[model samples]
Target: MNDTSLKANFLSFTGRAKILHMTWFAFFVTFLVWFSHAPLLLAIQESMGLSDQQIKTLLILNVALTIPARIITGMLVDVYGPRKTYSAMLVATAGLCFFFAAATSFEALALARFLMGFVGAGFVIGIRMISEWYPAKQLGLAEGIYKGMGNVGSAVAAITLPTLAIMFGGEDGWRYATAVTGVIALLYSIVYYKSVSDTPVGSTYFKPNKSGGLEVTSKRDFFFYLIMNIPMYGALAVLTWKVSGLGLLSELSANIVYGLLVAIYLFQARQIYNVNREIFHTPVEPVLQYNFKQVAILSLAYAVTFGSELAVVSMLPLFFKDTFLIPMSLAGIFGACFAITDVLSCPSGGFISDKFGRKTSLVILLSGAAVGFFAMSQIGSDWPISLAVVVMVISSFFLGSAAGCVFAVVPLIKRRLTGQIAGMVGAYGNIGAVLFLTVFSLVSPSAFFMTIAGGIALAAITSMFLEEPKNTLAEVMPDGTIQLIEVH
Candidate 1:
């Protein structure tokens, strides 16, 4: 594949490029709806007469269900194809958006936000869709473009929602502003359904052997997969604890919720065992096997990169306004700078991975993110606001780029399991958000930045073990013929 020629054709909306554009736009709409509340949070607080603690809980609730939603979405996309899965998700989340806009109480608002987290899973669908359309050689850039553009949804919300609210000219302006995003989502869902496909004409759309859980090639990986799943549930438990701490749940309710999480984890483990039980009796042949450690390392990498991005985007508007005494609208624009970096940084990360090596690109970006975040930890009220914004942009560049690098490799792990792998990795990113946001609720902003810096540093260290994709991957066709797909 000639990359230069392909790059020239990026603007051509035909063939695989059309799918890329359509899918990314679908993802963009989902994220726009998912985070439509962040910039207008102050208005929400005032409108609903919410407490400070409740406002923070709303941020936490915004990302909570995304953990499981991403996992479930991964399975659904793999089984039903991205076209159907993504369209249906958009339609459902559109209703959730309307419900949130109509909320008159904090409890109703929180419930609506929790359900809206499901929209976050739309990212996983495009990961699978783009991988199916693009060859491995060009996949990094393709996926980068997909994510970089799609992620602008959050930034778009930050930059526009405040103004949209102001234009409506009333206390209920925020409510109307939010409802408009739902209308866009509802309309786009139909457009997306009619305009795209599962794959290019005549291409095979691979399916996993099982649907209940990720299929592992060995017993060790089976257990390792189970271990990795714990953190996702653990993140949920942490959210429950935090909400209970805020008096949102009673002692009995919190304890019961914890018990339910444990039961759910055990049930999931049983399903995993059923899917990979054959591994105990027969080892997977080497040609068809890939390392599970790769997935683990990438998941951790995303936890810090995209995870911190989500957490920061949610809080940065407030952080800037509080620290600099700026107006809410100006603070939101500054916050937009963080995610806007994705336009260049994310695609750059993928392009770098395509040119260099995946492991090298990931390690360098992760290390840079740690340094960038450490710099952010030093920001104070005494510092110039301009300098603070500069620090944030630089840090966001590394963080967004690292996210691009993480997904650049996700599709190479196993073509058939790409959706599931993306789902698990994406879920960890939320887990990172939940934990980091919880820390933010308890500690100062400086402490929150340092905590994220430490997490990224740890992920960088673990990334040393990541194995790069081989030149080709062998898959069995439906007719029992072995097909080798070029990866490098």
Candidate 2:
């Protein structure tokens, strides 16, 4: 589509543009609910008389459940549809938000925060929804706009929630501010359900033949997929260890959590086997086969890109306040600058991927992110405040663009399996956060930045293995006729 047509399409109320609007708003609300506590974290800590370690624990808890939730939400969206899955998630988010807002103790707050991580999985639903509406040629731009804009909710929370809390002007102001976000999410969930459809009229929505796990084409891929799943659980175990080390959980409780993780991993592995066992008996045709390695690499890429985004956004305000001795309000605004870059940078990455090759775009963006993080590692109190803020904004731009580039390749991999693939990749983002944030909890700010830089460098090397998408993908239609979908 030309620029004029594209602008008109975006402005129009009918067709894919409307779906894009509704779906992005759904994602926006989910993110707003998921990170609602971030800007007001200090207020919550003061209100509850929490310790520094407790604050760190809450940040970690915020992302803990998202790792597994993305995997589950992905399957649900693939089987049911984005409309149902997103609406249900929003309802859940509303409840979690209310629970968190009304929490009277740390334990209650922690549980509510953990449950709210499920809201993060809402991102996966929109990926599938957008792929259904857009063609391959225009997919990157569309998906980028959706993600970049939706991500603004986090920035919105950072910028507005603090001010809202101030406006309410009391020890309980943060509580009321947080509750308002839930009410809006609850109302919007109903509105979203009414506004969108699973697919365009006359189009058939594809479902996976099996549920509970991703279906791989080859026996080797089945094993690889299982192996890739290990890190997700391992990240959770690391979080448990970190919390236990903080004296937050008893030894017996930590051990029980560890055992529970092991059992869940085994159960998930069996589900994967059940889903893909048929592949061993009957080999999948080459025409329908895809490389599991692509998924693995993208997962790692997202772990670094979006994962770093989560870990950094969570701690940046605190980092700024502690390191620079700035007021919390100013620190929050600075923290928001990191995420606000998404508006321009994310779409830029997608546009680059669409114009340049996908693999090439990812490599370039990932490299820039590694370098940017390395630069961030060098910042200290001696640095000028303006200079420090500029570095943060620049680093954020590269990281956000890298995230856009990663998803640009996701939908092109396998159309029908987009939800599952997006889910796995998205989960890895949280896994990355858990890993990086765990490192942050243990080390100094400089060391944490360095650790992230190392991880991004490694992910950039991994991106070299990804194969670019082919021109088209073949699928069997409901009428038993072969259909070709453009991918590149």
Candidate 3:
């Protein structure tokens, strides 16, 4: 189908599409509640007499748990399905949100904030769900819309939560504002559960034949899987070390900490087997198999796109204030435009992928992103701020489109294993965030932008190997009957 032909795909009502919309909305609320403290940090710091280092720690604590959360949640999602799992997570996090809002002491808030980080894993669950709902030809756009819209939750928190706090009009205004978001989360969990089914009611939901680790068909893929898993665990370990402030292990207890790390690693490796073991012993029919390379490619693509976006948002306000010599308020306003672009551009990218070919669309977008970031890196201090803003927006569009394009094919890889695939791919996005943020910590903004450019080029090269959507494939039902499905 051409771009115009794919236009009709968006307007039609789909049970899976409705579920996609609902699932992300819940994800959106979780983010709002998750980051509510950020906008109100000043108030919180003043009220609690928090030091800069302590507040920074709290900020770090907010996302520190999400790496494990994504991996663990990926396993559970395959076993339990996104419907029950995501709703349950949102509801539980809502309770945590209440704890965060109600906490009077920094320690109490810190604990609550850290635990709530699990909710950020909501992004991984929906990836599997979207893959199930759409055919392969359109999966890119469908996944794009879901991720793009849900991702706006971060921007929403940044833009609206502070205004909400002010509207409530008191020292406790931030508290009241936060509680309201939590309440929305609690109520919406029920609505999400009611609005969506795990799959079409009559359609069989395929389950992984075994549980614990992901099985690979080839020994080579098994090694590749192990290699990919390293970053996920390493990211977690890094977060742990960061929290413990253990540069030399002088400030924290290393023995207990290393033991804790070992325990988590064993648990994660076991989970990898749960998803992969069956694929090793029982060879899938040739038609049902997907390349591990595809997963690796998308993971790297996400590392560059979503990964850089996350790191950029975290630093852009500082980038703005320092480069432009603007007030904090003005810098914040300039910084926010980067986020707003994700919402519109993400869906647009998805739509483009659905209308055009997924691989074709992705290649074009990645190429655009490479150029965009390269330009951004070259922008000197004497460059026009408005021109810089224009450059940033352009960069965001390419980045968002690339995200839409990456997910477009996620579901088409393995139908029964969609959850695990999405989980791994989604985890890579987090891994990207961890990787980029780590790079940012070590390098200058110019170097950071250049690193991202190199990543985009790598992803584009991988995109060359991807096969475009072909309509013939078989999805084996729960009953063990093969049903030929049209992917395009």
Assess every candidate by TM-score.
0.94, 0.93, 0.91
lDDT of each: 0.91, 0.89, 0.79
Encode model 2's per-residue lDDT on 301-410: one tens digit a residue. Answer: 99998888888987899999998999998997898788789988877888888889899989989999999999999999999989999988988888988899888899
lDDT of 3 by residue, 1-488 (tens): 35654343565456555666787787788787877788889887877788887787788778878776776787788889888988898898789989988998878988988898888888888887776666565666677778877877877887788898889887888888889888988899898888887876666677767666654556568768878887877777666666666243444465576678778777766776666666667776677666687788778887788888888888888888998888988888877888878878887787788788778888889989989999989877899999999999999999988887787777776666767777777777777887888788889999998988888888888888888756765666776788876667
Q: Sort the predicted structures by lDDT, highest score first.
A: 1, 2, 3
Q: Candidate 2 — which residues are off by over 4 angstroms?
A: 1-8, 49-52, 166-170, 318-331, 380-385
Model 1: per-residue Cα lDDT at residue 115: 91
- Mind giving the per-residue lDDT tens digits that candidate 1 earns over 451-485? 99999999999998999899998788899888887
Q: Is candidate 1 or candidate 3 better by lDDT?
A: 1
Sort by TM-score, best first. Answer: 1, 2, 3
